[model samples]
Target: MSKEVSEEAEHAPPKDYTDPPPAPLLDVGELRLWSFYRALIAEFVATLLFLYVTIATVIGYKVQSQNDPCGGVGYLGIAWSFGGMIFILVYCTAGISGGHINPAVTFGLFLARKVSLLRALTYMVAQCLGAICGVGIVKGIMKHPYNSLGGGVNEVASGYSKGTALGAEIIGTFILVYTVFSATDPKRKARDSHVPVLAPLPIGFAVFMVHLATIPITGTGINPARSLGPAVIYNNRKAWDDQWIFWVGPFLGALAAAAYHQYILRAAAIKALGSFRSNTRN
Candidate 1:
């Protein structure tokens, strides 16, 4: 009976991946529709809330640490603020817009053919605008304290070279996007759907872990929008000077992650090669 059960399980088909065909470079068919606008609005609001909460946490942490270096929430708390917000926001907006609060994540998915050019472009614009508004609110409410803390803008620390900071952002973002892909992979999701929190949890944890590693070097700009929002608002020479690293690093990292996840780790290329070899042998 045990042998029969093992055989049956082995022959059971793997969970299906429900991916549609790659969308065209431009999908103008839905450009005039309400659904598209609703999705964009969702992205906007989610990103806005995300930036507001996370940046506020950073500013608050700085204020406390200034008063008493050891009394404040410290690095761990800051990491949690960013990660926890991501987990919550993703859970709330996943159904509406795939919960891509980060431009790097959206770009990665676009490269992997998960979103169309039109959707990707619009999502990016909305996210940036949302980030700007979110930080703008923080600045408005905490005017005196806001500029003092650089408004939580990401910048390279004194000792770290530009190369080191850029590399850190790249690897950090790669971990994030890779986790997003793995967590949301259809095969994994189909099997794990009963545990609804499973998908967003790892993604949040990735953000937390990356922050822990890179905070000392570059204040951890794994999200370009997160970096840009505050940098633009702060309008400082240093923040703007170091801004290119945040965008370039995250984008390159995201592209690497999309390619790795879709082609290698997920075995699409390997499976194709294996099938080809088998047919030739037969």
Candidate 2:
């Protein structure tokens, strides 16, 4: 029996992946579904927790460093806080809402036809609201320092020009969204089916690496929701002044990543435009 099973496995044909039709442009029926609302809730809660922890860390770091230059968790710790939260939250929410937690990510996936425009827009709204609430909680709890400190708002650092800051955000978000696509690709999934945890680790690492590289430039606004949250709460002129860079840069980055992943790396354009309509998403 073992010999027969081995022979059967050896002779089995390689599985082929066929493309599923793209997600509907507007899945109105989804609004009535409990699962859809559940997913929205998951995204909202995850983002809320993400912003709360990260912004609090930023505020705490600022307060500490003011008194003692070497004190507090420092920039490294702040990056860890953001990345670690992403890893944990993505792991927790991947099943429910794809664990976007970032509007730029949702936009990229939408461009790749992995998500519908409606779902992407709603997810972005929920994420933004969650972020605002998260930062509000931080302000309410740590009123004095939160106000005095910068409220963790992102902005172009003094030495950098707006163009440079925009460039940084664009590249940083491209790295992040590119990692998301690669990590979640069906090909990777099939090849490494035994190691499911691999997805969030690289995603988290990408965030950490981007933060390390660009934190000094634009305070790293790779996620529009992240930049929006603090800017809205802090209501600072400097933060607001540089706000366009966060949105425009991340969005452009996401678009570039999507086009590159779909048209070039995955050869999606060739497949669909050619004889085959191969699967792009699992």
Candidate 3:
């Protein structure tokens, strides 16, 4: 009886899911496909629209709030602008390019082997260019206010130490990237699909909540493209001084989130080790 029970346990079907084989590190053949270029276009346009709407809202709010303490859209509104734009863009472009408007998200997926290095780098470049163009359009439209107001630049706000700002960015970006991993997890998709439209909702809300928490610290730059665009267009020395934090913090956060989800939550390392041992014995 004991032998039979042990054999039954050993032969039990697998209970957990693992992602399929990882994407190639580089797939040069992707360049030959029209769909690949189409995806790039989708990412570019999504990011452009995201920056345009969000930055314009920020500049507008600053202008309004100065005149009347309650006149402008408050920080809450700014958060909504960022979060809502993300939700909208993600929903629109999910099928086309996975709607990665932020480089940090792309980086996280790359670390998890969800995207190739080539695609990741190209997406980041597209996002940055789109961001720059978006902000440029806003500046052209509202030159005086764009120059006078903050230009939606992210910096260490008054009374916040550099360390505090950096920490906020890192943690904030971790929340975002972690949410991305969770939302896109294959296991979850196999279970219920998250309704497609609803899949991006939580990711957007994550952005909203992080912005609310970190707005005062560093204007909440979980997305480097968002921060870099305004800084470049505005050309503010203060913004430039703190640029390192935005890039470093988000990338570090992406790394941490990917490691956490893939190694711990998914037990990828354990699975690989088990496979290696079984193969050696075989």
lDDT of 3: 0.90
- Locate the minimum summed-lDDT window of 10 residues in model 2: 273-282
Tens-place lDDT digits, model 1, residues 86-182: 9988888888889999999999999988888999989999999999999999999888899887789999999999999999999999999999999
Candidate 1 regions off by >4 Å? 1-17, 192-197, 270-282
Worst 10 residues of 1 by lDDT: 1-10
Candidate 2: residue 173 lDDT (0-100): 96
Q: What is every candidate's alpha-carbon RMSD to the true fold?
A: 5.1, 6.8, 3.3
Worst 10 residues of 3 by lDDT: 1-10
Ranking by lDDT: 3, 2, 1
Give lDDT tens digits, candidate 2, residues 46-139.
Answer: 9999999999999999989997999999889999999999999999999999999999999999988899888999999999999999999999
Best by lDDT: 3
After superposition, which runs of candidate 3 have C-alpha atoms over 4 Å from their true positions?
1-12, 15-18, 192-197
TM-score of 1: 0.89
